[model samples]
Target: MEHIPHGSPDDPNPLRRLSLEQLRRRTSIKWRAYPEDVLPLWVAEMDVPLAGPVARAVTDAVALGDTGYPAGTGYAEALASFASERWGWDTLAVERTRLVSDVMTGVVEVLKLITSPGDAVVVNCPVYQPFYLFVEHMGRRIVEAPLDERARIDPGGLEDAFRRAVRGGHRAVYLLCSPHNPTGTVHTTGELAAVAALAARHGVRVVADEIHAPVVSRSARFVPYLSVAGAESGFSLMSASKAWNLAGLKAALVTAGPAAAGDLARMPPEVGHGPSHLGVIAHTAAYRDGGDWLDALLGGLDENRSLLAALLAEHLPGVRHLPGEGTYLAWLDFRALGLGDDPAAVLLERGRVALHPGPPCGTGGAGHARLNLATSPGILTEAVRRMAAAL
Candidate 1:
């Protein structure tokens, strides 16, 4: 395969041109989690170089010693602009946006403002693992609404869960993962609208985690949950962390819909204190000036997605995978190979390729693993080959 041209959006390739040797030298969790012999595909981190604009913004801030407490709404304004241009969400209110340390942190703060301890929080199963972890850590109980046979959200299942969540007149929260993690099922606008209607009728508040919205494939459109009708009561958590590979910066935004503004205002002022000043600068640059680089990345990811399907078919035919319309993570079913419920453990111990275990994602995760697809074609193919060899 041809190498992606680094830093050029017009090149039509999105994979970072960096080689494995270069990536392995980094101290990120993705590379350092396992021994040198293991191929790490477990974490969400992408093997990509920073966008030119983002790097420049951070470097400029460092050079001037501008690092300090974050101030102003520049980050929010950039997000508003990006939303309007990218998703046609022109009514997104920049003034109503609040900054937080990260997407998950923002989610926890939002949940705390709306519900009390022991309140039920609903989630679709096989979701981003942190959703389950954080909700429980916040002194709330988790309610699973597992996806349907097609691995997409089932309206009936969601409504049932919502009803159960609100039983005994308890306030409930629904944590939605748009462009859902693990499965990579990008929820359609119609689906989101229906969800909004259901949540309204059931008196449930929806908190959408839309951090992966920017990285969706061209085949699908990312519908902002708050943009749907009847969603004025919802909250949205967004960031440049996932799309721009800036997780270490620790900055994210929490935005409230028209009806939920008061709820957001109720959040403690200290909730905003943890965001890094440099994170605001870098994320602002990403939303305002990193379009070309992001476009290039999308192109590269498009190719990688296809390449992964082909490689899996050839090397590990027994592992069933659905070609996702968004995100770089691929959900693979290893049940056909009888790898047991925790295929990831087998892959790590025998195949020497680390992957996220399926069981931890709750129901619908048995005998499965989530593979990160944001790496070079060679590495992905090799990982598949190793899995095949292990079996």
Candidate 2:
């Protein structure tokens, strides 16, 4: 078998160093879901090599056949150390964190502990599509607190949603996507503090999906929801999967704020059983030793975002892209092209380019598309070229 290199952690532009041929050979949904002719810039997966530390950790575990049920507090400890060193969040205690299979699962579990079946889950629209799916799957009604024109949390919109959500005296949980997906809007500290105050006043529980916490650009700071002054009652789900490209590893930590610890304590013990042993090993290694690689990846993503902006301007002038401050996903508005509500369908059909359709992203997503910017510069150029050709 020939060994294929996935580029080094030191690469200035890690995304550019990847081999498109090798990426095409991948069996992940990002590659397999589409036919050979279609270029996939839809899924959240990045087209880069695994970080050295992460690779070694997973490889060693498999070589030693250490695959078994997950145990110990190492994952939590690693995250705590990372949070302190990276974001000055020293209050993330290991004792207050629990292991879960993945982020969405952790979210559902937390919601179960705090709210009933008919309870409402509030979300900022043009969000990660799964929020609607998972919340509804758990028998919770979803209330949209759509982001404002700039993709930032709308204070008035949120207040209105909260009022409507709890109108029947029903328990409500705000499923916040920090450093929001698609748009890549990293919420400010003041914004989060205001949200905490609002949730407190409305008698709503806050569950932050901070999976993209570590993926922020240098221009923005990621404030942990619990780090805010009035956020002591909020819950957060943190994971290294998104930042480190370890989505297949399946491990996440559900953390409770100081005041919410008692509520988290009621969760069933078996909920922790779902995380695979290897998953814990990979995620712990990522939090503990993957910093350098992550920094490099972020640098690459920064360049890619800029490249996408330039490409869109030169080729797809009618398209509007509000460059995100975090995550490698780019939310593009194609209404100027007059493609109706689903421009992605036209792009896929005519240009053989697959971008995540906007309609599924809920209200405010019409005539929009989410493009994955975690790929090589050449691929991004080609995708825009194809899109322009389609137009």
Best candidate per lDDT, number?
2
Tens digits of lDDT, candidate 2, 1-391: 1233445435566685676787888999999999988889999999988888999999999999999898899999999999999999999989999999999999989999999999999999988999989999989999999999899999999999999999988999999999899899999999999999999999999999999999999888999999999999999999999999999999999999999999999999999999989999999999999999899889888988888989988998899889999988999999988999999999999999999999889999999999999988778878888889888
With a 3 Å backbone cut-off (N, CA, C), the pairs that clash in candidate 2 are none
Show the lowest summed lDDT stretch of 10 residues, model 2: 1-10
Residue 263, candidate 2: C-alpha displacement in angstroms = 1.1
lDDT over C-alpha atoms for residue 60 of model 1: 94
* lDDT agreement of model 2 with the native: 0.92
Candidate 1: stretches off by over 4 Å: 1-16
The lDDT of each candidate is: 0.91, 0.92
RMSDs, each prediction? Answer: 2.4, 2.7
In the range 244-295, model 1's lDDT, one tens digit per residue, is 9999998999999999999988988998999999999999999999999898
